[model samples]
Target chain A: MLNIKDLKVSIEGKSILKGINLEVKPGEVHAIMGPNGSGKSTLSSVIAGREEYEVEDGSINFNNEDLLSLDPEERAHRGIFLSFQYPIEIPGVSVTNFIKTAINESRKAQGLDAMPASKMLKKMREKMRLLEMDQNFLSRSLNEGFSGGEKKRNEIFQMAMLEPKLAILDETDSGLDIDALRIVANGVNKLRTPENATIVITHYQRLLDYIVPDFVHVLYNGKIVKSGGKDLALELEDKGYDWVKKEADNLV
Target chain B: MEDLKEKLLSSFIAFESTLNGQAKSPIHKVRTKAIEVFEEKGFPTKRNEEWKYTNLKPILKHDYKLLSHPESEIEFKDVKRYFLHDTDTYKIVFVDGVFSSWMSRTTHDGYDICTFASAIEKYTHIVNKYFNKAASQEDSLTALNTAFAREGAFINVPDNTIVEKPIEVVFFSTNSDTEMMTMPRNLVVVGKNSQAQIIERHQSLHGNNVLTNVVTEIFAEESSHVSYYKVQNDEYTASLIDNTYVDQKEKSNCTVDTFSLGGKFTRNNLNFNLTGEHCECHLDGITIIEDDQLVDHHTRIDHKVPNCQSNELYKGIYDDKAKGVFNGMVMVHPDAQKTNAFQQNNNILLTDTASIDTKPQLEIYADDVKCSHGCTVGQLDDDALFYMRSRGIAEKEAKAMLMYAFSNDALKNVRIASLRSKLNLVFAKKLGVDLDFGL
Candidate 1:
């Protein structure tokens, strides 16, 4: 579903991601775990086509199309969604209207009419139920004065609504409590389908216990140094990243 | 002397000839003194402190054909859309420079809702008392308008009368061969314990290059409430210089909201004199200009008595090569104790070429008073842009949404629902958004 070849990224002439390659097929889930400043978020942002990240030398192919050549909105139209680490608080724009505009805009890009209001409302209610969000939450401004958990949950709610082909949850479990984490993980697990894929980017192994990943990769520095199954997450949690950091330092 | 200024002097002689030797009349004496002031001041240059950021030379160069009478034969159907047809309103409409009685819906049940021309002749005593009472004789532009202030809206509400329906005054200029000029002078007197709301607009139909130099004087009597909405939108070829003077009495409250949605070169000189104790005055404005358009707002609030309060908030969004200027001044006299005055001006420049000059000039003589002002200029947030773009919304639409949010606060105090919705449509259209956000 997604392919990256020799992905080298930098920002403001400072190299962040060195040569790296990854691939994900449909019907699979991949979890990228790393410590702070390990370029985990950068990878997700680069895949989402953030303009600030200069793709020094890389090619990100999504569903046989060159994603690097497309704008962020164009990539979004092609089912590439990046759940932000910190959501923006846009005042005066209700969440319902924001979602409606996003959905209609994506549909418009694909040459389709807007979804009827009734259908949109039904879909929204169903999605809200999946996330256990209240009905009034749809009318509030997007992320304005919202709790951290609510912001992350709202991200998942949008992901469910858009039903993106490749969903990258960048640090979605950071500011959530145990109960909120369970709910968020449950929401993500419910949205998982054989036709779509998920990449859970986190700093800990706690979230993996709820939405178990099919593959686990440890990203140290810029490149993925180790790859294993679900058990690898427990191994990293048991022993800290110091040993991994030593190994990566020696290798560099 | 400049050519236009020199031409105006000669034009004054021709204008006076039309008056049929009413030179000894008190209003005519006021006009004669105003013309002398216009001659003395000529036209404000960039050197003048108040007119620093605005350059009137380009507009002053035009040999304008001052329209004394409305010659355009306009039907009700042609201009019905301009009125607030959905809402119950008392309309005092003017076509060119003449009162369109056929298109207006005024009343004589209690209030003298009529034309300025008729009021000057019929209610000469009342006109003589209030005419040019609040407007500054020192302002060359206001003086120029006073010299030919024979037309426009004239509204007088007696004491203790509540004006139930909103009054809408619309001025439309039709397509003329030459670049025409229309000077509308409006007088609104809200009596003691009375309340009134007004919406004034200047529009041009299928024409370019019309200048409307308007002067409006409002008197809010003791314990009265007045809400005025100046909805200024016109073609890029149409320019406007609006001079509005407002005087508030004891315990009176007045609010003026100016929406400068579209125009070529616009200047708003809004002055409020808080003459009595415990008076409240509010000045809210929203200016969104694009292309090479320029809009300047020079507002002043004078707290002359004790216990007066004033607030001003002006928001502007400039795109392309558009320019804006906001010079808000608040003056508190020595005896005006406990005066609470606040002014805030926020702007967002959408392009590299777009710019604004904003300053808050406060002159306070009273030591025991609260006066604060703030101004901000910035572009759209980068993180906000990325967030919206990643949600499948394009960059342009995202910017428009941010602008709408920035300008939403300035529209919060619009009391008229239909007029507010109409402004919402105009605001959305200008920002190129597709939502009827009634904020």
Candidate 2:
């Protein structure tokens, strides 16, 4: 369902992702594990088409269409979703209104009419209940004065609402407590389907205990150094990044 | 044309003599001082600091004839009809700047209301104490109004009497004869522990080039509450200069809101004095100008006593080649410690040619006071615009929606429901935004 070939990206003339190649099929959960500054976020941003990163060389193909040729919102309309590391707070706009606008815009891009308010409200309530959010969260301003865990949960709630084909979670567990992590993992696990794919990017294997990735890749120095089954995440967690660095250096 | 200024000056002199001829006491003294000030200052030109951005060249170039008391009486049918609940409440009407006794109503009990001309003779003591006390001839135009103050409205509320009904005064400028200038003065007094609301509306009927210079002074006594609303919807060729001065006593509350949507050149002066501790004052304004109109609002709130609170917010939306000016000042006296004062002026320039000059001033001499003043002039946020556009709303509708949202905070602060609805209608007609969008 997704193919990336030697994707080299740079921001402000500094190359962040160098010659990285990855592939994933439907019904598969791919976990990218690396230490800080390992180009883990660069890969996700490059796929999501954030304008800040300059694609030095490479091509990204999603279902046989050039992903890099589209705008941010265009990619968003094409079912490319990236859960932000830090969600921006939009004041004076309620979360329900924001989500409705997004859904309508995406649907319009596909030549659909605006969704009815009644059905949208019902769907929103069901999703909010799934994430254990209060009724006030739906009416309050979008992400304004929201706690860190609440913002993450709201992101997952948005993901459920949009139901994108490919989902990328970047550093979603960084600021979350253990309870928040479990709840977020449960949300991600519940949304998995055979027709969609998930890419979980993290630094530790703690999240792997719940989401259980099918493929685990260790990324270091702007390139994916090794790819293995789910046991690779546990081995890296026990031996630390230096052992992996030595092993990759020997392989090179 | 050469003798027009001389003719206006003599007309004002004749008016002064007639006013003093009727009652020659404290009011005569005040009017004489105002005339002297007018003679000294004359009319302000573009050289003045306050009048620099707003030029009166058009007014000065025209040969405006003085409008005397007309022989044809002003009829009640000329005024806009309002099905108010209180039928016994009085009404004072001004036609071509002259007070008309036949066009007004009266309550049997003098405690309720009466006309200014009739009440002047009966309640001279009450009128003498507050007449011209708050707003005087500080400027040339103000002095000119004072010189021609032949007729005005004087309202007095008895101590501890709650005036449940609103006193409505209609000031109509008739230009059926020729280009005219009308000046109407008003004094409203709220007695101790009394409550009242007043609506003074200014309109021009059958007037092509009419000018209305109105001065209203409000005295809110201790523990009293006063709410005043000024609605200016005149002809395109009409101009207005309305000034309101409010004085708040201990524990009293005063709110003054001015809605300026229709006028060629509109200038308003609002001054509030918090003379007693624990008194609160609020000044809110919204001005929407189009087609090269010039709207200027100058407000000053003086915190004269300790522990007083004052809030002022004035917002303007200027489109086409229109220009807007807001000069607001919050002054804290030296002895007024622990005073809380806030002032903000924000403007949205829809077109590149549209201009705004907003100045929010804070003069603090007192220690241990909380005072803040800020002014912002900019176009809409680009990110916000993109966000709204991405929602499938067209660019024009999204712009209008954002502009309406920008003004929502200011209009929602209006406490009166009827007034809020009226103002919303005016805004909706201009911006094409439905009034029930967010409510």
Candidate 3:
């Protein structure tokens, strides 16, 4: 459902994603493992149409549409979702209100009417149950004073509600505890379908244990140097990123 | 002496002279003083200290035909539209500058609701005591308002009597093309241990280059509770200068909220004096200006006695070359020990050309007081906006979402639902932003 060819991106004229080439068909779970500043997050933001990253040379095709040509909101309406590394704290906007607006906007883009209030509430309650989120969480302001674990779980809740075709989890496991990681993984696992795809970007191999990836890619120095089955995640976890960098140097 | 010289000054030397003929014996003393102040410091030029940010060159170019009485009759339907919904309160309507006894309700047997003219004749001492006490001739706008003071409503709640409904005073300026000026003098006295809520609404119809100068004084006695809500919504060509003052006695509670959604070159001076022990006051204002509109708010809160508390918060959102200014001051007197005063002014500039000048000042003479003031002027939070946009909300909706959230802190303080909803609608429409969760 997603194709990225030689994605060369830069921010402020500094090279970030040097040459990223990746492909993920429907129902595939791909995991990208890299150390900090290895361009893992930059790749996710680029595919989700964050304006900060300037595409020096490359093309991204999502569902036969030019992903790079769309605005961030337009990308979202076209079934592309990005779970931010750091959730934003929007004060005075209730979680329910925010989620409802998001859902309605996406639906309207697809020429569909907004979900009725009763159905929307029911759907939200069901998603909250799937994520094990407290009912009071819906009434509070979005991410304001929320715990790290709660924020991650809320992101998963929103992901479930939107049901995007391609979901990009950008460091979703960065701040999660063991229980939160399990809840987040379980929620993602439940929403999987043969027509959808997910790209899990993380440094640790522990998250791969819950949502097992069909493929794993190691990113180093702004390039994907190695690609393999899910076992590569375990190898990287055991050897660390330094081993990968040394091997790439030896190969070059 | 300035005071003596003011008495000798003509109350009607300017373009409009009929005001001097209508000034009663009780109000003449102050009227003369106001004229002297106006002459000494004519309309403020750009060089004046207080009028530095705001330019009044447009008003000086025109000659205003002074209006002292109601020129045309206003129907009850029009007055009803200005009344607060779901409240059975007395309605006093003022057209041009004269009170409409025919349109006002006279069944208020429990409350002392009378016009300024009738009150001046019946309660001469009360009218003489409070009438120009709130606004002084030191201010050019205040002087201009006083030099042509005319008929307005006087509301006095008896001692220990709690008014269940809110008293509304509606001021309408209708159909005058030439430069016109109308001064509305309102005095609200909440007796010792009484409680009441008052709403003052100013609306204009069918005129360009018209001016409305209003002065409102609220005397809140010991342990009395009063909430004053002012809505300044009028024609884009109309200019308004409103001076509101509140004097809180021992243990009294007072709140004044000014919502400036629509106007052209509007300036508001709001002052809260916590004069007695353990008094509390809250002052909040929100102004949404766009399309070359200019709005200014100068607010001061004085803590005089020990254990008094005051909180002042004002926010402005401007777009499309609109200019906004907010100057807030919190003064804690030497004797006002343990005073807790907080002041905050926040502004959001939507367009690059839109501007806001905000200054929050806190003067603490008492060492034991806790006082802090802060001001922030910036665009919407980029991270918050991006987050909303990433969720499929359009750029405009995302901006509106954050803007409304920014204003929610001030709006939540309003306890009245009807007033809150109306204010929310006005804000949304003025900002050109729609609210998904409509009130």
Q: Candidate 2: give the clashing pairs.
A: none
lDDT of 1 by residue, B1-439 (tens): 3386677777778888878856678999999999999999878999999988989889877767774566567777877777786899998988778787878898878998999988988889889999999999899999998987788899999999999999999998875666778889999999999999999999888565888899999999999999999988888988999999999999999999999988899999999999999999999999999999999999999999999999999999999999999999999999999999999999999899999999988999999999999999999899999999999999888888888888877888888889887888888888988783222
Tens digits of per-residue lDDT for model 2, B1-439 = 7444466678766666566456476666776788778777877787998877888768655556675566345555545443133244457776766665676664636464655666567777877887777775487777777666646777788779887666768777667667777777787898889987777887777757877777888999999998887776667888888877888899999988877788899988888988989999888888888898889998989999899999898888999999998999889999899999988888999899999988888999998999988989989766555444433334564566666656756665565566666666667778776443342
Comparing 2 with 3 on DockQ, the higher-scoring candidate is 3
Best by lDDT: 1
**Tens digit of lDDT per residue, candidate 3, span A119-180?**
99999999999999899999999999999888889998999999999999999998999989
Task: Report how far residue A13 has shifted in candidate 2, in Å.
Answer: 7.3
lDDT of 1 by residue, A143-236 (tens): 9999999999999999999989999999999999999999999999999889999999999999999989999998888999888999999999
- Among all windows of 10 consecutive residues in model 1 chain A, the one with the lowest summed lDDT is A240-249
Model 3 chain B scores worst on lDDT over the 10 consecutive residues at: B1-10
lDDT of model 1, residue B23: 64
Clashing pairs in 1: none
Worst 10 residues of 1 chain B by lDDT: B430-439
Q: Model 3, chain B: what is the TM-score?
A: 0.91
The full ranking of all candidates by TM-score, starting with the best, is: 3, 1, 2
Which candidate gets the maximum TM-score versus the true structure? 3
DockQ for each candidate?
0.53, 0.14, 0.74
In terms of docking quality, model 1 is: medium
**Which 10 consecutive residues of model 2 chain A have the lowest summed lDDT?**
A84-93
